[model samples]
Target: MDAMDVDYLNELLEQDVEIREKIKQQVSDLDKKVRVMVGILIKIHSTPTDTLPPLLDSVRPILRSCHDTSAALASLVPPNQFWRWKEMWSNSLRTAVYSAALVEYLSSGSLITLSQASEVLGIKEEWADRFSIAVEDYLHGLISLVNELSRLAVNAVTLGDYEAPLRISVFVKDIFAGFSMLNLKNDTLRRRFDSLKYDLKKIEEVVYDVSLRKLTDSTKSAVRK
Candidate 1:
């Protein structure tokens, strides 16, 4: 590796550290938030219909922002479908907690077993298999997107360009839009999608860090030689 590669490596280290900190902070906050929401749901369980809207309204954004952007960066790894965990929670704030777990997982570039997800969603063993399959399918598309985008990013950087994939973002936006429409029809499903959106973002951000580190190291090595 040359000086350029070294520089790039250093930059990536910094970026990785930064992302780790951000992920940690976000996870801590999300945990507290989920607990509060769960308490609220329990308090208003008898009148779930009334508590549901306010709960959804308050938690919607957290659900929206937890997307797995790293999947886009990597191409082969599908975006983990945090939303699909909704099968366990079934129309409460389960969407939000799932998103939180998902973001935490994506941020770490880890695989979440169906059992873990099922447990988090309070789902039983029999139904978890079906829901796990659905999550995997959804994750497949995300992984494809991430892998393709990663290829694009690698090629672009090699060619001396480094712009975020706005086109890919548009694609993600459109898909989410469809889900949004679906949300309007069924609140449970909608919240599930919302969780997915946020989880993907976290994934993408981590993938970006990985790429930048690779690039920075590559460049620094070249610079040194």
Candidate 2:
């Protein structure tokens, strides 16, 4: 190649690196904010309803900040490369956690639907078209919530909150059913879907065990009375 050609290629390469680095920093800050929200969600998940509003309130501003960063990233990255860039942001799991938390909080611990996720993310049709962002991004996050709820079920039962396991079992089963209906193409998402069955089974077992214990306790009480 000519010297000018070589220099041109080098300059392009440097610009590409700079762009990636800038995106990395932005995404890193976004992820940190997401992490704080996730931490609050963990506390909220275990604590009683009375403790939730303040924690959830704390998350809204952070979520808005995340939304702004996401919009900026979407604008900066090429359409073809946006999905890949989103994966690199590594926010899917936390985003899903946030969605799950918001839905549960709003509905008194019920799972949220896709439409509700749009509401939670404050994503409108116009904004989605403008930013080229997909609702599937939030839906993908819900997959992570299934895993979390399964673990939560086991822990809830252990903590003597048997009702929690029942709720989780029903919710996880619904989520798994919904996932089964989709024609998911992403390898990571598909694999995560496959793994959900294990969580479903674990939560089911906990529910069964809790039911059996309650049954036994009732029988003992009847026998004594």
Candidate 3:
């Protein structure tokens, strides 16, 4: 090729490299912040269920930082590079979803909607609507919550907190019913949704076991009368 063509190609390659490097740095920072939020959430999840309120209160600011950093990173990603970087930030969305749902469940024992997740992340619902990092991505996080809740239901029963399992069972069924109506084309989300049935079964089993134990005890008590 001619020298002019060679120089122009080299310049374009250099620009592309620079853009990638910048995006890498921003994604790295965003990933780090998200990991911290996830760590705190893990701690909260491990805590006794009754003690989660204060732990959630402590998590709010870190979660806010994660949201802010992720939004900044999203803005910095050039339109041409969005498809390239979108997967990299899915972790952030996952953590945001799990955290939001946990906070809502802890507060009210209910499933959180996408709009509620947007409010938790402190981002505009409109901004999250058309972007790859939108509330739809957070929907996957709800799947994670279902998995967690199933485990929590078992643990609650072991700890003699029978009511918690029933509550979790109902919430999980509600979430599963809602997910069934969505026309998800994203393969990753579709696969994740597929796992919800297993989580639903696990929670139902826990609830059944708890209810059976209650019935057995009541029957024995009546026999003693």
* Worst lDDT 10-window in candidate 1: 69-78
Q: Cα deviation of 157 in candidate 1 (Å)?
A: 63
Model 2 local distance difference test score: 0.66
Best by TM-score: 3
Write the candidate numbers in order of decreasing lDDT. Answer: 3, 2, 1
TM-score result, candidate 1: 0.26
lDDT of 2 by residue, 68-148 (tens): 665666566654564545556545434744554554634476766655655554444444433333546655677777767
Kindly list the per-residue Cα lDDT of model 1 for residues 1-225, writing each as its tens digit: 999999999998886576445544544554555565445433322332223355545544534432231111122212353342323322222334344343333234343444554444343444332222244334333333333333443344444443333333444455556545542444544454556566457446644764566545544576679
Clashing residue pairs in all predictions, respectively, total 46, 0, 0
Superposed by TM-score, candidate 3 places the C-alpha of residue 118 at a distance from the truth, in angstroms, of 3.0
Candidate 2, superposed: residue stretches over 4 Å from native: 90-110, 113-119, 122-140, 158-160, 215-225
Please list the residue runs of candidate 1 whose C-alpha ends up more than 4 Å from where it truly belongs after superposition.
Answer: 44-225
Per-model TM-score, in order, reads 0.26, 0.75, 0.80
Clash list (residue pairs), candidate 3: none
Lowest lDDT block of 10, candidate 3: 125-134
